[model samples]
Target: MPRAYEEIADERQHGRDTHVRRPRARVVRDSGRHQWEKDRARRPPAVRAATGATERDTGLLPDDLVFSARYRTIEAPGELAEAFGVCEGTALLERSYRTRYAAETAPFSLVTSYLPHALAAANPDLLDVSREPWPGGTHHQLSTVGIEIDRVEERVSARPPTPQETRELELPAGTAVILVRKTSYDTRGRIVDVSDVVLPGDRTELFFTTRLERW
Candidate 1:
Protein backbone atom coordinates (compact mmCIF):
# COMPACT_ATOMS: atom_id res chain seq x y z
CA MET A 1 0.00 0.00 0.00
CA PRO A 2 1.09 3.59 -0.53
CA ARG A 3 2.48 5.04 2.69
CA ALA A 4 -0.29 7.62 2.90
CA TYR A 5 -3.04 5.03 2.60
CA GLU A 6 -1.32 2.85 5.14
CA GLU A 7 -1.17 5.72 7.62
CA ILE A 8 -4.82 6.59 7.04
CA ALA A 9 -5.83 3.00 7.55
CA ASP A 10 -3.88 2.80 10.76
CA GLU A 11 -5.48 5.95 12.13
CA ARG A 12 -8.97 4.81 11.21
CA GLN A 13 -8.45 1.45 12.81
CA HIS A 14 -7.43 3.11 16.07
CA GLY A 15 -10.16 5.76 15.97
CA ARG A 16 -7.51 8.45 15.71
CA ASP A 17 -7.30 11.42 13.36
CA THR A 18 -9.39 10.85 10.25
CA HIS A 19 -7.80 13.66 8.28
CA VAL A 20 -4.92 11.54 7.12
CA ARG A 21 -3.78 12.36 3.60
CA ARG A 22 -3.19 9.74 0.98
CA PRO A 23 0.31 9.65 -0.47
CA ARG A 24 0.82 9.82 -4.21
CA ALA A 25 2.61 7.16 -6.18
CA ARG A 26 5.71 7.99 -8.26
CA VAL A 27 6.38 6.53 -11.72
CA VAL A 28 9.69 5.94 -13.53
CA ARG A 29 10.02 5.34 -17.25
CA ASP A 30 12.75 3.64 -19.24
CA SER A 31 14.09 5.24 -22.42
CA GLY A 32 15.08 1.87 -23.83
CA ARG A 33 16.39 -1.48 -22.59
CA HIS A 34 19.81 -0.02 -21.93
CA GLN A 35 19.35 0.38 -18.17
CA TRP A 36 18.70 -3.33 -17.78
CA GLU A 37 21.80 -4.45 -19.58
CA LYS A 38 24.98 -5.31 -17.63
CA ASP A 39 27.89 -3.45 -19.19
CA ARG A 40 30.06 -2.23 -16.33
CA ALA A 41 33.26 -2.78 -18.30
CA ARG A 42 32.15 -0.49 -21.12
CA ARG A 43 30.34 2.20 -19.14
CA PRO A 44 29.61 5.41 -21.00
CA PRO A 45 31.52 8.59 -20.29
CA ALA A 46 28.76 9.95 -18.10
CA VAL A 47 29.49 7.23 -15.57
CA ARG A 48 33.12 8.32 -15.52
CA ALA A 49 32.11 11.96 -15.16
CA ALA A 50 31.54 11.48 -11.45
CA THR A 51 33.62 9.71 -8.86
CA GLY A 52 30.19 8.41 -7.95
CA ALA A 53 27.50 8.29 -10.60
CA THR A 54 23.78 8.15 -9.94
CA GLU A 55 20.69 7.73 -12.07
CA ARG A 56 21.99 10.38 -14.40
CA ASP A 57 24.97 8.17 -15.19
CA THR A 58 22.65 5.83 -17.04
CA GLY A 59 22.55 8.13 -20.08
CA LEU A 60 19.40 10.02 -19.10
CA LEU A 61 21.41 13.25 -19.15
CA PRO A 62 19.48 16.52 -18.93
CA ASP A 63 16.45 14.46 -17.88
CA ASP A 64 16.72 12.78 -14.47
CA LEU A 65 14.72 9.83 -13.23
CA VAL A 66 11.73 10.75 -11.06
CA PHE A 67 10.54 8.62 -8.17
CA SER A 68 9.26 8.47 -4.58
CA ALA A 69 10.37 6.23 -1.76
CA ARG A 70 8.33 5.05 1.20
CA TYR A 71 10.53 3.98 4.09
CA ARG A 72 10.04 2.03 7.30
CA THR A 73 11.91 0.13 9.97
CA ILE A 74 10.72 -3.27 11.05
CA GLU A 75 11.75 -6.63 12.43
CA ALA A 76 13.49 -8.65 9.80
CA PRO A 77 11.14 -11.03 8.04
CA GLY A 78 12.10 -14.71 7.79
CA GLU A 79 13.34 -14.57 4.23
CA LEU A 80 15.14 -11.30 4.81
CA ALA A 81 16.78 -12.69 7.91
CA GLU A 82 18.11 -15.65 5.96
CA ALA A 83 19.44 -13.39 3.24
CA PHE A 84 21.16 -11.14 5.76
CA GLY A 85 22.49 -14.08 7.74
CA VAL A 86 21.01 -12.64 10.87
CA CYS A 87 18.60 -13.85 13.50
CA GLU A 88 14.91 -13.14 13.01
CA GLY A 89 14.71 -10.34 15.56
CA THR A 90 17.13 -8.08 13.74
CA ALA A 91 15.90 -4.67 12.69
CA LEU A 92 15.94 -3.62 9.05
CA LEU A 93 15.47 -0.40 7.18
CA GLU A 94 13.18 -0.89 4.22
CA ARG A 95 12.91 1.56 1.37
CA SER A 96 10.07 0.91 -1.03
CA TYR A 97 10.15 2.69 -4.36
CA ARG A 98 7.97 3.57 -7.36
CA THR A 99 9.74 5.27 -10.24
CA ARG A 100 8.33 6.90 -13.35
CA TYR A 101 9.69 8.45 -16.48
CA ALA A 102 9.77 12.17 -17.12
CA ALA A 103 6.23 13.57 -17.37
CA GLU A 104 4.72 10.12 -17.11
CA THR A 105 2.37 9.11 -14.28
CA ALA A 106 2.72 5.32 -14.29
CA PRO A 107 5.66 3.49 -12.78
CA PHE A 108 8.07 1.45 -14.88
CA SER A 109 9.09 -0.68 -11.94
CA LEU A 110 8.59 -1.30 -8.23
CA VAL A 111 11.62 -1.66 -5.96
CA THR A 112 12.19 -2.35 -2.29
CA SER A 113 15.57 -2.49 -0.57
CA TYR A 114 16.39 -3.82 2.87
CA LEU A 115 19.45 -2.84 4.85
CA PRO A 116 20.50 -4.49 8.06
CA HIS A 117 20.31 -1.96 10.85
CA ALA A 118 23.63 -3.03 12.32
CA LEU A 119 25.44 -2.42 9.07
CA ALA A 120 23.64 0.79 8.19
CA ALA A 121 23.80 2.36 11.65
CA ALA A 122 26.98 4.23 10.77
CA ASN A 123 25.17 6.59 8.44
CA PRO A 124 21.99 8.00 9.93
CA ASP A 125 20.90 9.18 6.49
CA LEU A 126 20.44 5.67 5.15
CA LEU A 127 17.58 5.06 7.55
CA ASP A 128 15.58 7.99 6.21
CA VAL A 129 13.70 7.91 2.94
CA SER A 130 13.65 11.69 2.71
CA ARG A 131 17.39 11.52 2.09
CA GLU A 132 17.08 9.27 -0.93
CA PRO A 133 17.90 9.44 -4.60
CA TRP A 134 21.14 9.31 -2.56
CA PRO A 135 23.20 11.58 -4.81
CA GLY A 136 25.63 8.88 -5.95
CA GLY A 137 23.47 5.92 -5.09
CA THR A 138 24.16 3.25 -2.44
CA HIS A 139 27.76 2.65 -3.43
CA HIS A 140 28.83 6.15 -2.50
CA GLN A 141 26.71 6.02 0.60
CA LEU A 142 28.35 2.83 1.84
CA SER A 143 31.81 4.13 0.97
CA THR A 144 31.28 6.93 3.44
CA VAL A 145 31.13 4.35 6.21
CA GLY A 146 34.23 2.33 5.21
CA ILE A 147 32.23 -0.48 3.64
CA GLU A 148 32.91 -1.35 0.03
CA ILE A 149 30.58 -3.47 -2.04
CA ASP A 150 32.72 -5.88 -4.00
CA ARG A 151 30.07 -8.20 -5.31
CA VAL A 152 26.49 -7.87 -6.46
CA GLU A 153 24.41 -10.97 -7.01
CA GLU A 154 21.20 -10.69 -8.95
CA ARG A 155 18.74 -13.56 -9.21
CA VAL A 156 16.00 -13.18 -11.78
CA SER A 157 12.76 -15.06 -12.02
CA ALA A 158 9.39 -14.64 -13.69
CA ARG A 159 6.00 -15.46 -12.36
CA PRO A 160 2.41 -14.25 -12.09
CA PRO A 161 2.13 -11.29 -9.82
CA THR A 162 -0.24 -11.24 -6.91
CA PRO A 163 -3.53 -9.33 -7.13
CA GLN A 164 -2.06 -6.43 -5.18
CA GLU A 165 1.02 -6.38 -7.46
CA THR A 166 -1.22 -6.48 -10.51
CA ARG A 167 -3.01 -3.39 -9.27
CA GLU A 168 0.18 -1.58 -8.24
CA LEU A 169 2.14 -2.27 -11.43
CA GLU A 170 -1.03 -1.77 -13.50
CA LEU A 171 -0.57 -5.03 -15.30
CA PRO A 172 -3.15 -6.54 -17.63
CA ALA A 173 -4.60 -10.01 -17.32
CA GLY A 174 -2.23 -12.92 -18.04
CA THR A 175 0.75 -10.60 -17.91
CA ALA A 176 3.83 -11.97 -16.19
CA VAL A 177 6.19 -9.99 -13.98
CA ILE A 178 9.97 -10.11 -13.91
CA LEU A 179 11.37 -10.29 -10.39
CA VAL A 180 14.97 -9.36 -9.70
CA ARG A 181 16.42 -9.98 -6.27
CA LYS A 182 19.76 -8.23 -5.91
CA THR A 183 22.05 -8.75 -2.98
CA SER A 184 25.08 -6.62 -2.31
CA TYR A 185 28.04 -8.05 -0.47
CA ASP A 186 30.96 -6.22 1.06
CA THR A 187 34.59 -7.24 0.67
CA ARG A 188 34.27 -9.18 3.92
CA GLY A 189 31.43 -11.22 2.43
CA ARG A 190 28.82 -9.53 4.57
CA ILE A 191 25.49 -8.85 3.00
CA VAL A 192 24.94 -5.12 3.11
CA ASP A 193 21.70 -4.73 1.24
CA VAL A 194 19.13 -6.77 -0.61
CA SER A 195 16.79 -5.15 -3.09
CA ASP A 196 13.75 -6.65 -4.72
CA VAL A 197 12.71 -5.21 -8.05
CA VAL A 198 9.56 -5.87 -10.02
CA LEU A 199 9.51 -4.99 -13.68
CA PRO A 200 6.58 -4.87 -16.04
CA GLY A 201 7.07 -7.87 -18.30
CA ASP A 202 5.68 -6.11 -21.33
CA ARG A 203 8.25 -3.33 -21.18
CA THR A 204 11.35 -4.86 -19.64
CA GLU A 205 14.41 -6.69 -20.98
CA LEU A 206 17.69 -8.03 -19.64
CA PHE A 207 21.17 -8.42 -21.15
CA PHE A 208 24.48 -9.87 -19.97
CA THR A 209 28.08 -9.81 -21.22
CA THR A 210 30.80 -12.35 -20.54
CA ARG A 211 34.40 -12.76 -21.63
CA LEU A 212 35.81 -16.25 -21.77
CA GLU A 213 39.50 -16.96 -21.13
CA ARG A 214 41.38 -18.63 -23.95
CA TRP A 215 42.99 -21.89 -22.94
Candidate 2:
Protein backbone atom coordinates (compact mmCIF):
# COMPACT_ATOMS: atom_id res chain seq x y z
CA MET A 1 0.00 0.00 0.00
CA PRO A 2 2.95 2.37 0.63
CA ARG A 3 4.33 1.69 -2.82
CA ALA A 4 0.88 2.17 -4.36
CA TYR A 5 0.49 5.55 -2.56
CA GLU A 6 3.93 6.71 -3.81
CA GLU A 7 3.03 5.74 -7.40
CA ILE A 8 -0.26 7.68 -7.14
CA ALA A 9 1.55 10.80 -5.92
CA ASP A 10 4.04 10.60 -8.82
CA GLU A 11 1.13 10.22 -11.29
CA ARG A 12 -0.60 13.28 -9.82
CA GLN A 13 2.61 15.36 -10.07
CA HIS A 14 3.15 14.41 -13.74
CA GLY A 15 -0.52 14.53 -14.75
CA ARG A 16 -0.48 18.23 -15.87
CA ASP A 17 2.83 17.97 -17.81
CA THR A 18 2.48 18.68 -21.54
CA HIS A 19 4.83 17.73 -24.38
CA VAL A 20 6.07 21.10 -25.72
CA ARG A 21 9.46 22.63 -26.38
CA ARG A 22 10.73 26.16 -27.02
CA PRO A 23 13.01 26.81 -30.04
CA ARG A 24 16.64 27.43 -29.10
CA ALA A 25 18.42 30.60 -30.25
CA ARG A 26 20.89 29.77 -33.03
CA VAL A 27 23.95 31.73 -34.27
CA VAL A 28 24.00 32.25 -38.02
CA ARG A 29 27.29 31.23 -39.65
CA ASP A 30 26.95 33.20 -42.95
CA SER A 31 28.95 36.44 -42.80
CA GLY A 32 26.75 38.04 -45.49
CA ARG A 33 23.59 37.27 -43.54
CA HIS A 34 25.03 38.68 -40.33
CA GLN A 35 26.23 41.85 -42.07
CA TRP A 36 22.86 42.31 -43.77
CA GLU A 37 21.06 42.08 -40.44
CA LYS A 38 23.46 44.59 -38.88
CA ASP A 39 23.03 47.06 -41.73
CA ARG A 40 19.27 46.77 -41.54
CA ALA A 41 19.32 47.46 -37.82
CA ARG A 42 21.52 50.53 -38.26
CA ARG A 43 19.33 52.08 -40.93
CA PRO A 44 16.94 54.81 -39.71
CA PRO A 45 13.32 53.78 -39.56
CA ALA A 46 11.98 56.72 -41.62
CA VAL A 47 13.19 58.54 -44.73
CA ARG A 48 12.63 61.99 -43.27
CA ALA A 49 15.25 63.62 -41.09
CA ALA A 50 14.85 63.37 -37.34
CA THR A 51 14.14 66.42 -35.19
CA GLY A 52 17.10 68.81 -34.76
CA ALA A 53 18.87 67.28 -37.82
CA THR A 54 18.08 70.23 -40.11
CA GLU A 55 20.08 72.65 -37.93
CA ARG A 56 23.26 71.19 -39.44
CA ASP A 57 21.95 71.26 -43.00
CA THR A 58 22.74 74.38 -45.09
CA GLY A 59 19.49 74.54 -47.01
CA LEU A 60 17.58 75.72 -43.93
CA LEU A 61 17.53 79.45 -43.13
CA PRO A 62 17.79 81.19 -39.73
CA ASP A 63 14.42 82.96 -40.06
CA ASP A 64 12.78 79.60 -40.71
CA LEU A 65 13.89 78.73 -37.20
CA VAL A 66 11.90 80.78 -34.69
CA PHE A 67 13.76 82.12 -31.65
CA SER A 68 14.01 85.03 -29.18
CA ALA A 69 16.73 86.65 -27.05
CA ARG A 70 16.41 88.41 -23.69
CA TYR A 71 19.27 90.46 -22.28
CA ARG A 72 19.96 91.03 -18.56
CA THR A 73 22.74 92.10 -16.22
CA ILE A 74 24.16 89.64 -13.68
CA GLU A 75 24.62 91.36 -10.31
CA ALA A 76 26.14 88.58 -8.21
CA PRO A 77 27.40 85.07 -8.98
CA GLY A 78 25.68 83.64 -5.92
CA GLU A 79 22.38 85.23 -6.93
CA LEU A 80 22.76 83.81 -10.42
CA ALA A 81 23.47 80.37 -8.99
CA GLU A 82 20.34 80.59 -6.89
CA ALA A 83 18.18 81.89 -9.74
CA PHE A 84 19.44 79.38 -12.32
CA GLY A 85 20.12 76.62 -9.81
CA VAL A 86 23.63 76.21 -11.18
CA CYS A 87 26.85 75.94 -9.21
CA GLU A 88 28.25 79.17 -7.74
CA GLY A 89 31.57 78.58 -9.47
CA THR A 90 29.75 78.50 -12.78
CA ALA A 91 29.04 82.20 -12.52
CA LEU A 92 32.42 83.83 -13.03
CA LEU A 93 32.28 87.64 -13.10
CA GLU A 94 30.78 90.35 -10.87
CA ARG A 95 28.70 91.82 -13.67
CA SER A 96 27.68 90.26 -17.01
CA TYR A 97 25.03 90.32 -19.70
CA ARG A 98 22.59 87.44 -20.22
CA THR A 99 20.79 86.76 -23.49
CA ARG A 100 18.22 83.99 -23.84
CA TYR A 101 16.69 82.69 -27.08
CA ALA A 102 14.66 79.83 -28.40
CA ALA A 103 16.04 76.68 -30.09
CA GLU A 104 12.80 75.72 -31.90
CA THR A 105 9.36 77.26 -32.47
CA ALA A 106 6.83 74.43 -32.29
CA PRO A 107 8.65 72.78 -29.41
CA PHE A 108 10.22 74.39 -26.32
CA SER A 109 13.33 76.48 -25.70
CA LEU A 110 16.73 74.97 -24.98
CA VAL A 111 19.78 76.74 -23.57
CA THR A 112 22.04 75.74 -26.43
CA SER A 113 25.01 78.09 -25.80
CA TYR A 114 26.43 80.74 -23.40
CA LEU A 115 29.06 83.51 -23.38
CA PRO A 116 30.01 86.65 -21.46
CA HIS A 117 29.30 90.01 -23.13
CA ALA A 118 29.69 92.48 -20.27
CA LEU A 119 33.49 92.45 -20.01
CA ALA A 120 33.71 94.14 -23.37
CA ALA A 121 30.95 96.56 -22.46
CA ALA A 122 32.74 97.51 -19.25
CA ASN A 123 35.90 98.75 -20.93
CA PRO A 124 35.30 100.85 -24.01
CA ASP A 125 39.08 101.07 -24.52
CA LEU A 126 39.43 97.50 -25.90
CA LEU A 127 36.49 97.69 -28.27
CA ASP A 128 38.50 98.88 -31.28
CA VAL A 129 40.58 95.73 -31.62
CA SER A 130 39.32 93.61 -34.53
CA ARG A 131 38.47 90.11 -33.36
CA GLU A 132 37.56 87.26 -35.70
CA PRO A 133 33.90 86.99 -36.51
CA TRP A 134 32.01 84.11 -34.95
CA PRO A 135 32.09 80.97 -37.19
CA GLY A 136 34.53 82.79 -39.60
CA GLY A 137 34.38 84.49 -43.04
CA THR A 138 31.92 87.13 -41.79
CA HIS A 139 33.40 90.53 -40.97
CA HIS A 140 33.80 91.65 -37.35
CA GLN A 141 30.97 94.14 -37.49
CA LEU A 142 30.75 94.59 -33.73
CA SER A 143 34.46 95.11 -33.31
CA THR A 144 34.55 97.62 -36.16
CA VAL A 145 32.07 99.66 -34.07
CA GLY A 146 34.29 99.40 -30.96
CA ILE A 147 33.01 96.13 -29.57
CA GLU A 148 35.45 93.23 -29.36
CA ILE A 149 34.93 89.65 -28.27
CA ASP A 150 37.79 88.04 -26.38
CA ARG A 151 36.55 84.72 -25.04
CA VAL A 152 33.24 82.86 -24.87
CA GLU A 153 32.08 80.17 -22.43
CA GLU A 154 28.90 78.19 -22.97
CA ARG A 155 26.54 76.20 -20.66
CA VAL A 156 23.53 74.14 -21.75
CA SER A 157 20.49 72.74 -19.91
CA ALA A 158 17.03 71.33 -20.67
CA ARG A 159 13.63 71.34 -18.97
CA PRO A 160 9.91 71.43 -19.69
CA PRO A 161 8.34 74.66 -20.95
CA THR A 162 6.25 76.89 -18.72
CA PRO A 163 2.54 77.25 -19.36
CA GLN A 164 2.97 80.65 -20.99
CA GLU A 165 6.03 79.59 -23.00
CA THR A 166 4.15 76.54 -24.21
CA ARG A 167 1.16 78.57 -25.39
CA GLU A 168 3.25 81.39 -26.85
CA LEU A 169 5.91 79.18 -28.42
CA GLU A 170 3.32 76.67 -29.64
CA LEU A 171 5.21 73.71 -28.22
CA PRO A 172 4.37 70.13 -29.13
CA ALA A 173 4.18 67.01 -27.01
CA GLY A 174 7.34 65.31 -25.75
CA THR A 175 9.43 68.36 -26.61
CA ALA A 176 12.36 69.72 -24.57
CA VAL A 177 13.80 73.21 -23.95
CA ILE A 178 17.48 74.17 -24.33
CA LEU A 179 19.30 76.88 -22.41
CA VAL A 180 22.65 78.31 -23.60
CA ARG A 181 24.98 80.41 -21.46
CA LYS A 182 27.36 82.48 -23.62
CA THR A 183 30.34 84.41 -22.28
CA SER A 184 32.52 86.64 -24.44
CA TYR A 185 35.95 88.08 -23.78
CA ASP A 186 37.82 91.08 -25.18
CA THR A 187 41.22 91.23 -26.91
CA ARG A 188 42.83 91.49 -23.46
CA GLY A 189 41.30 88.13 -22.56
CA ARG A 190 38.85 89.76 -20.18
CA ILE A 191 35.34 88.44 -19.73
CA VAL A 192 33.18 91.04 -21.50
CA ASP A 193 29.82 89.51 -22.31
CA VAL A 194 27.48 86.95 -20.79
CA SER A 195 24.16 85.92 -22.30
CA ASP A 196 21.68 83.06 -22.03
CA VAL A 197 19.48 81.71 -24.83
CA VAL A 198 16.67 79.16 -24.82
CA LEU A 199 15.70 77.12 -27.87
CA PRO A 200 13.22 74.48 -28.95
CA GLY A 201 14.67 71.54 -30.82
CA ASP A 202 11.76 70.64 -33.05
CA ARG A 203 11.30 74.00 -34.79
CA THR A 204 14.74 75.60 -34.60
CA GLU A 205 18.04 75.34 -36.44
CA LEU A 206 21.50 76.54 -35.36
CA PHE A 207 23.76 77.29 -38.32
CA PHE A 208 27.52 77.35 -37.87
CA THR A 209 29.82 77.81 -40.86
CA THR A 210 33.60 77.66 -40.58
CA ARG A 211 36.00 78.68 -43.35
CA LEU A 212 39.25 76.73 -43.22
CA GLU A 213 42.35 77.55 -45.23
CA ARG A 214 44.18 74.74 -47.05
CA TRP A 215 46.64 73.08 -44.74
Per-model TM-score on C-alpha atoms: 0.72, 0.37
**Top TM-score hit:** 1
Compose the digit string of candidate 1's lDDT tens values, residues 11-34: 767878654234333323332222
The digit string of per-residue lDDT tens for model 2 on 1-215 reads 23433444455577743332222111111213222322333345342122222232223333334433333334346755554345565633332212112222133332322223343354443232232112211013234345455444556677886776566545566767665665555676654344555665445444334457998
- Model 1: lDDT of residue 207: 52
Q: RMSD for each model, in Å, please?
A: 10.3, 22.4
Instruction: Name the best candidate (by lDDT).
Output: 1
Off by over 4 Å in 2: 1-145, 204-215
